[model samples]
Target: MKALDTWERVLLTLIALVYLAFGLGIEGFLSPYALADSTYNFSEKALIALAMALLVVAGEIDLSIAATMALCSLAMGFAMKAGASLPLMLLAALATGLLCGALNGWLVTRWKLPAIVVTIGTLSLYRGLAQVVLGDQAITGYPQTLSTWGNGSLGDLIGVPALIVPIEFAVLVVAGLAVGLLLHRTLHGRRLYAIGSNPIASRFSGIAVDRYRMGLFLFAGVMAALAAVLLTGRIGSTRPNLAMGWELDAVTIVILGGVAIEGGRGSILGTVLAAVLLGSFTFALGMLNVSGIVMSMIVGGLLIVSMVLPRWLRLLQRGARPALRTV
Candidate 1:
């Protein structure tokens, strides 16, 4: 039902068409194994997208999230080099993410700076710190278990290829469900919509607007850090370029999912479905040997279409109804 909402239906249809087109044209493209494996392509960015959705719905944005991930991964590397255990390494990344997020939140909420401006500054700052620290080097040789878990699957663990479900995909699903519920079902969620729609009115009506904004930004940072953990685990190393340029991808997926860039109109289900659509699109293109340049063009074109089509349809639907009004 969630995926069948007015706009979400369109996303589902697109996803289906992509799979059908790719499946018909590319051998083995529709195989369960292949489809399941594609989750890794977008899982990390999608995780940040989920948190970013909440922030967007609350009338804020964090362009520094990818940078946060880079910094977090670098922190994890530092911990590993210091002989931290696996859990401590994970903690290091998360704490760094939280700190970065808190800084953004503080700058925006306390100093009354615009969120976009604050995050953009931090984005450069965070990534620069990582680049400066690593300086044309990478940190590697993490504990083997981290790599195993990063690339492992439920089916792989159980030794059943037929049950193939990427552990990353499983985590994404759980997070999607959790965030969807939080955004759609709780009083706190309702307040976010209220805040985005009219922050002054919501504040006058007793909502803790700044508090929500701060929390959402913090949440965005933590999710990005979690993504960093997974990505580091997968590659078994920390590179300055890790997750570079992912913030745009995350925002693009959120917008494609039908969230209003201005705020107050979107759903987690739509964002999650959009994420799946993108993963499938990239996977399909890769299967058909589509060049990266062409694929980027196609994706950019789709982003434009997603932004315009709804407004165009709304205009068409208006149908000059003002003339039918009885004065």
Candidate 2:
């Protein structure tokens, strides 16, 4: 356990240091304004990626998370249109997300279908539903106070408002700590690991593998909902197309963070660092006026490299082992 903890910390530190270098490099070479604006997306997207990291670590994936977020925002928009209170709108958004999660979980568990298939079907289904709810209409003119949740930054420091932290950053930090603890310091977490590593063995060991998978899907759903709330507040509008393809971004970050896709092996610290790294990378590229297509290419290349390198290394070692035995 201690070794594993150390490894996790090491990986996180390595990513953090890489970001620090990149941040400074960009600051020295580029305009300060570029760095400042970059912080917003880096921070906001990091929060969304957190839930995705956890879901992947548990050996399941939710392709509909992006769609779920969009739907949640639509629900909040409907609530606002109905003159609902801010708190009530928040509840509606979260509840809608939970229901989406529960539906996905039920389909996957009850029917014993592959999660990828279930989520892919729901990804289109949920986003389609969001479009139906909004129908190319924009939900604008939300309450000013509610917008503050996403847009307000502390301006006063030392008798003056000086770059007050964004609420999204606070959410990211809190969510990171919570997820880190939940993954590292609980029996339920160990069970998740067991199930991910070997489902059959976990079942024989009396672990309720299906229940655990369902719970993870549910948790991810709620987190995605929370992300939607933040996004809606920040943008001051709800659109059905919001958060499209975010599921892939989350998966990229998870894999880049060193989470094994086959499950049973991963760390929250690594995922958090990878989230930050990816965000920083995107921001830096954007500052250079890189095309969106190029950015996507870079991200895709990284994901492929991260996934394949470890397996390639293992294969090389396996081949060497046979040679040694023959010798």
Candidate 3:
């Protein structure tokens, strides 16, 4: 707990209060009606953001994650076309994601490429592969059980079954816990921060900075693959365009959660809160009949403000210290 700085604590508190107010005070915010229809969207987005937060903290980025997910979903669909069983299809999806992650890692670590550049290239490459696989078509008729897990909940209420706790939500919760541990509670987490703070110094201290970065990429890939599965379950189909332009959303959540863009700082809790806040805000805006364009602008503006506020405060403090010293 002492490890958390003042700003982090304050951000966490602020996000918590926002979520609480939105969840409890706002009408239709988490009502049974909205939960039945829109919980999956919030859950899926939250799950994806968890993995993304870790990637940003490690000083690496994976713009290809959404594409990786789409490719994996497409692979599963393609496998089913070839008469593959459910387990086989899942294995294929996981393998596709892992392979992409490894390739991205190899390019960045083994070849000394920047992660942003590598992932940006692979983002197109992977999505292009998905396009080739699906090509203006979608694969349907997945196993019934997969759909049930994807779209079904644990129990029913009156007539509705509580949106059936999305498999994506379960996966996201687990991933979030794992990442929070990795980033905040372990020696490896410390190493990651050290690497992010100063790669050359981390190397001198015997950390395999490149290897850690690669590991983070692979982890991000796996999480994205899981998100892909959840998405397939929710939609009950696979298409090349699935999860498109989602990288920005993931980045937005991380940044809004108060993660430092320069690296070496962030909180999974903050990310989770930011995810909820953004989801609720979007939903609220929609409920109020706000235009999608205006909603996007509001989100973009909020992100900019969140990022700038910390710096602005620091600048003010620096200016004030000179006057106080002179006095």
Candidate 4:
């Protein structure tokens, strides 16, 4: 806890305040079941944002993640309509994600294109494909298992009739823990920060900077696919509009998690906490029946503040340090 930076500490405190305030002010907000269920609203986005955190930390960004989700969901829907079983439908989605991720990675790494530009182009391409396939229609008929996994509670799955814990939330927590370990406990993670901080130096030091970038993008695709599956199941349909504008939310979660926009510095713990903080705060407002448009505005504002505030504070600290030395 002591090692946590200022931003992370702020996140923790903010989370506590959100929970406390909402619990007291909103009816049922503190109910165990309600708390668990609220997590469902943002679990998929948080899951993808975890993957997005890695990419942002490595000094690259993927604007096409939401589009990737749209395409993957359509792939699943198409497979299901063609009489594919549950596993096969899932495979279709994963395969689509794999191809999209590979393409994004290749364009950025092999062709020396800027990641932001590449992903933005692919974003349109992927969404265009989804729109072409969907075309003012919705796809449904997903298996019952999909619904159970998406909407059911852990208690429902395990036969605990009295317990009402959301399964999706549990999955998010597990995923967050795994990402934290990968970022903080592994050599591969170190190389990512090295490349992000200075790719030229890392390459000169024999680190495979391009390889890491490509791999990060590839993994981003898979996570986007997973999020797509969860979202499709939760909504019980797939459409061209699925996960639209979510790239902004996903990026907000990462940047708000304290990952530097320019790359090089961040922690998985900060990201997970940021997810919780954002989710809890939004969930509270949602209980008040706040408009989705307002929610999005808050998300956008938070993104800007998170990016700018820390740098400003750091500058103030540096100036204060020099004055202290003079004294």
How displaced is residue 169 in candidate 4, in Å?
1.2
Q: Give the better candidate number (1 or 4) by lDDT.
A: 4
* TM values, all candidates: 0.94, 0.87, 0.86, 0.95
Error of 2 at 131 (Å): 1.9
In terms of lDDT, model 1 sits at 0.88
Q: How displaced is residue 156 in candidate 1, in Å?
A: 3.5
Residue-level lDDT of model 1, residues 64-112, one tens digit each, is 9999999999999999999999999989999999999999999999999
Q: Best by TM-score, which number?
A: 4
lDDT scores for all predictions? 0.88, 0.79, 0.79, 0.89
Candidate 4 residue-wise lDDT, 40-152, digit = tens: 86899898998899998899999999999999999999999999999999999999988999999999999999999999999999999999878999998889899988888
lDDT (10s digit) by residue, model 3, range 149-199: 677665532246554554555666777788888789999989988877888
Give lDDT for model 4: 0.89
Residue 4 shift from truth in candidate 2, angstroms: 14
- Candidate 2: minimum summed lDDT over ten consecutive residues — where? 1-10
State how far residue 283 of model 2 sits from its true place (Å).
0.4
Give the best candidate by lDDT.
4
